[model samples]
Target: MRGIYVFSDLSLHERLQKALAELNLQQPTEVQQQAIPKALDGRDLLISAETGSGKTAAYLLPSLHRFLATDAPKSGTRGLVLLPTRELARQVFKQFKQLSAFTHLQAGLITGGDDFKYQRSIFRKNPELIIATPGRMLEHIKRNSCDLSDLEVLVLDEADRMLDLGFAEDVLAIAENCRAERQTLLLSATLKTKGLMQVVDRVLRDPEELILSGARDQHGNICQQIVLADDRTHKERLLYRLLEKEQYNKVIVFTNTKAQAERLGGAIRYRRHRAGVLQGDMTQDERNKVMDWMRRGNINILVATDVAARGLDISGVDLVINFDMARSGDEHVHRVGRTGRAGESGLAVSLISASEWNLMASIERYLRLQFERRVVPGLEGKYKGPAKLKSSGKAAGIGKRTKGRGDKRRGESEAGAKKPKQRLRDQKSIGKRRKPSGNKPAGDQAGSGALGDGLAPFTKRR
Candidate 1:
């Protein structure tokens, strides 16, 4: 078959090409164009590509081709894909199954929150491709239920997220169990973190470095906007209004907390929209069902926490509403990335309050672009924040502290000034007590107080 693109030439296996065609993938993505050929050449790869950039397939197709080309026994795992979350592992496994459809290569998923014995049963099948989370995979390794002795390729999908989730030790442990000569492919949304670099140094050898532009730049197709909300209630109203007014094929509302995700999902469902909740608190089976509902259009809206929705590939998500501003700029990027996938245009609206304005500004600075400020006509918020920003365009009230020496000295003087008034009141009380009463003499009073104390001592002893 002729190549679809200049880069997707004879380097890829014919079966892989047929699978790509069946998936309607006519051309290689930028990351795939750059990384796949080198990966096929048996080079250790460190790829940094934005979400929804076909990074999964970039690594998967090459690994599948290598497995199909080799005569090595499929008795032990040969290709290992380690992700940070169970959802990501399952999604990658699904992708692997799709790409390997024309070949006999088997892929198995092992993650926590699932039956270990059932996974071990899958392991007995001698799958060549293994998709798993670091923690669960490490458990299997320690239990002697899974073996990586014959592992040829180790793919760390979302290495940065794994490190964020504190899976560094687990990932390194799994890598240690794999053969030293294994080809390590590390893929991340960003590779600037020290932890990811350390993993790269430990696993990859003279790796081919491919760093694509960040998600913010790549997601220009997403129309970003900011809605000013006075408070949580106002944000909720704005969210409901947006959902009611705007037309979207499918929408994802992102919240910072699982509680908030559940609340918002419930609220949306109560409003008569088919909405589903995806958060860390949900069981693996429940999460899978929610994802299935979202994918199959049973639910038109999905409210999800950041960690739960990371690396999820749901297509045709037309709009993303950040119900709560993301904790960081990177998080904001990933939250919005759930939409505008695969060259489709999408919309992202972040509901920002007075407290979240600074966060929104930081994300704007990180992305090097300003979000268009929007308002609901009748439902305009009272907290519009600073009328004018600093020269850097960040929110004006932030990064300014009132803890200088002058303020400290002022506070000290105020506290010190109050002491004199207290001392004066004490002096007045002493003077009043010293003033002689009509019925008693000063010496008599002292003698009487002393006598009363002596009597009290005797009474207490009794």
Candidate 2:
């Protein structure tokens, strides 16, 4: 409770302070400290902060405060939250419920994979706060089951992810229906993408831009490492050995594809470890069951794809294993962010094969740090890879094609040598060419040149 006074100093409602106290949340996170005040002032916001930075609470508290302080009736969903995934929507809904426990504000969740009838029934009541995914929310809007005319605040959570999932049009359509003067907030891990900016221009109005520490700066508590493997088999062996050796409370192994998640989950279970699989293709119930098992310690290992695991707020994750290298640096940051949350010490290990070395290097360059390379005893990889590294620390041979001084000089020499030969051939060809005869008509000559006979130009002799 040492820093509990800091939140009160922000002029938050007493009820919210009580709720925060009950949750044992003392100090406001950096994102909360900066975002909450401006959001409370009813200003449009565009925030770029790291994952696991309490961004949910940053926007939730202010919106809840505004609702609780107002004397207006619970009209058509005063507060609306749009997320990229159902899991994230569920997570945000849970948090909203917890924070608004002492208030009269009712928050309803609208996402896919649930009973449509049940969701429609909830929408009929028109809860003051609504958390939903873009696709399902758009569907409800189209069916006339949802209303946004009275919405006072609209929050787009994980805005970049929404654009990445191709929900930009749906989100924009939903925004278009909201009150023109409604307060809009766009929160994301990165704001550099063009798609996000397009949505921002469409929705937010003169928003106050807040840029906080990014993912690279938030890796203080995570120990990152990379292990080279010869191939998939070697990677599996390495992963199996790590699971057997490392003492972790909970671990999430990330793969690039759903099939890989299933295969890895099965392999981990075969080794007698409690493991579960999560992917985008799974129904909401199935995904919830897997997440519940992991939370309750029934599953110590969860194999997941990036889409299924994004914005998931699970606690007690001590290790994150990249069973397959992430396709992008941002995805790598998000996968490893599952661990090292809430100031807990964690480990992130990447199993890199020779083919993925360049990818691993790019991730390192993106993070601006080199991961410690580890080798397991008696299981060393045969593919040592290139011994040299480029100045950027990437694998030496994988650099972009750049001409060196010698290469430039040789190219110039080759161009000069070929020019004289080309000119000589051109001159000889010019000497051998027959000139057009001035005696023939222009059209006839043109026709004779193509058809080898001037008579082909006309049907009869002219």
| TM-scores for all predictions | 0.86, 0.84
TM-score (C-alpha) between model 2 and the true structure? 0.84
Instruction: Tell me the tens digit of each residue's lDDT in model 2 across 116-213.
Output: 88999998887898999988888988999978889999999989888878998999999998999799999998876558888898899999999886
How many clashes in each structure?
0, 0
Best by TM-score: 1
lDDT of 1 by residue, 102-174 (tens): 9888899999999999999988999898899999899999999988888999999988888888999999999
Top-scoring candidate (lDDT) = 2
Error of 1 at 83 (Å): 1.0
Residue clash pairs of candidate 1:
none
